[model samples]
Target: MKKFKVSLLQLDVKFGDPEANYSNVEKYIEEAVQDKPDVLVLPEMWNTGYDLERLETIADKDGQRTKTLLTRLAKHFAVNIVGGSVATKEDGKFYNTSYIFDRKGQLISQYQKVHLFGLMSEDDFISAGSTLNQFIIDGIKAAGVICYDIRFPEWERKLMSTGQQILFVSAQWPTKRIEQWKMLLCARAIENQSFVVAVNRVGNAPKDSFNGHSLVIDPLGKILEEGATDVEGIFTCEFDLDDLKAVRGNIPVFDDRRTDLYF
Candidate 1:
């Protein structure tokens, strides 16, 4: 079906505490599934909130715990899951990673955050990812990226070029720059002529306090649903992929791209 429902779990993550976060995440997922959304998304760094220094110790080893938890939940609910960015360790190196699981609990895709936020000291502890995140979920072409990746349009363009109808962004954006977060999301949706579902965490970390303005935007840059600032709740919205044809046909942005003249 072209029509699909998406839900964002705008949760408050506890810093450096994977066990508590795990319990909280499970509770949130149970709450979110009540909406019966086809796809459920979580915020960036949900497992460990910018606990950069302790990443070597706190990061999920091989993402085994996260994978198992999300997989079981996905299968139980019969829902697709975008297990938002988590701090993971592989081969003794840490990375901000995201996992996607299909309804049957099959792992469809995994992406390490390509653009590490140097300002947050992410580069010092977490390794950067080099690959793009593109996949299909619930019969719809979609892509997922972490927090800081939203600032880079070219990277998003590359993913959308594949004709993905939905772009899922998992972020832990701070209150200081929340406006930019909203603007950039809408801009990406308008530019790509694709749906944008962004989930940001709320509450405070050691240094930064996040404002959850989780949003669901249409191809036309219209807000389908938006969460209250700093509220921890599930925000659900429904839209049809069939609408993309009319939107893209009218603008023809992708078709008219002059790739040869641009970088």
Candidate 2:
């Protein structure tokens, strides 16, 4: 179906508390499902919010706990899920990973955040991902990326070049740069001619305060839906996935690329 609805969990992540975060996610999912959206998205590090120093103790072991929970929920609700980035430990190294599950609860995509934010000390603890997250959801081609990845237009363009109609971004963007978050998401939509569904966390961590301006933007750079700053809630928006074709056709930016010049 070209028409699809998406719901975002603009959550307030509990610092270093995976158990409490898990319970909160369950509760949020129970409420968000009432909208019956085709896809449900969670914010980055929902399992552990920027609790860097303690990642060794709290990160999900090979993402087992996260995968099990997301799989079960996706199957039970019969909805696609973009299980946002979590701190994961695998083979003694830690990574910021994101998981995507289909309606059948099958794992569709697993991506580790490639660009680590040195400003947040992410570089010191998390190993950068070397791959891209591209997959099909409910017959629609889409991609997923974590917080800092949005800053790199080339990275996003590389994914969009593969014909993905929608880009799903999960983040814990700080309130200090909330304006940049909005501007960047809109720019991504306008430039790539694809829908951008971004979910940012709310509330505060020990070092930063998150302003939940979670957004759903159309290909033409129109803001479909946005959440309030510092308010924890579910935001839902619907759009026609096929509209990207018309937008791209009108501009033909992708077709006019000079691949020979750029390296």
Candidate 3:
């Protein structure tokens, strides 16, 4: 039950410009690695912030560029990375994809946003991803989900039931719904008895203003570390597996779940 340190890259993403966003990510990664964190996380759509109309044009082609940089940095820093979601184009279709890299710089998992936000018109532009992926990070079972995906408790529970210890969420959630983001993520952790490490972007977009409340919540629903609403900075925190065991042992939510009644 060793403790793991995490560094969250909470930065504003420029709308409709992949080049600027990529450059910003590179600069932030440089700063983040300096801390020598055990793991690094980024916000959703860091490459192109909800530039839905231009996704077909501005999206990363095959995600090669993003993969290259994330791989290089992960290898260089020898840190595990839960790369935030990026707008990636493949086979003439666009998807909001999240990539994961291990300390060895190997691509571990890729999850597209399974639940698209119709309110933001994401359904109109992006193809929904179908697979739920699980991987190991620093010997911890982990998985990544996009912004709106957290709303579906069943989806999160499904993954958690499959031995997922850490749930990494990358979001461009609107300021108006920051409360929902906070409540839902805490609920996800409390109900599932797992650590929830979520990162949200700060600053404004044409549709909504994002106030980064990037959070690191323990299985007991305690906010161990939280980012300010408008600040763009790297926030780091540490979590130990002992926390998970203590909480789960006390609550026994997983053991007490009514499996027969769960239809």
Query: Please, what is the whole-model Cα lDDT of each candidate in the order they appear?
Result: 0.93, 0.94, 0.90
In model 2, which regions exceed 4 Å deviation? none
Over 1-263, each residue of candidate 1 has an lDDT whose tens digit, in order, gives 37899999999999999999999999989998998999999999899899898887889999999999999999999999999989999999999999999999999999999898888888989889998889998668899889899999999999999789999999999999999999999999999999999999999999999999999999999999999988998989998889999999988998899989984
Measured with C-alpha atoms, the lDDT of residue 195 in candidate 3 is 89
| Model 2, residue pairs in steric clash | none
Per-model TM values vs. the true structure: 0.98, 0.98, 0.97
Per-residue lDDT, model 3, residue 176, is: 90
Off by over 4 Å in 3: none
Ranking by lDDT: 2, 1, 3
Mind giving the per-residue lDDT tens digits that candidate 2 earns over 42-92?
999999999999998999999999999999999999999999889999999
Q: Which whole-number lDDT from 0 to 100 does residue 9 have in model 3?
A: 92
Better of 2 and 3 by TM-score: 2
Stronger candidate by lDDT (2 vs 3): 2
What's model 3's overall lDDT?
0.90
Candidate 2, backbone clash total? 0
Tens-digit lDDT track for model 3 on 1-263? Answer: 68888999999999998888889988998898888788999999899998899887889999999999999999988989899999999999999999999999999999888999999999999999999968898778987788899999999888888667889999998889899999999999888888899999998898799999999999878999999879999999988877777777787776777899992
Candidate 2 whole-model C-alpha lDDT, 0 to 1: 0.94
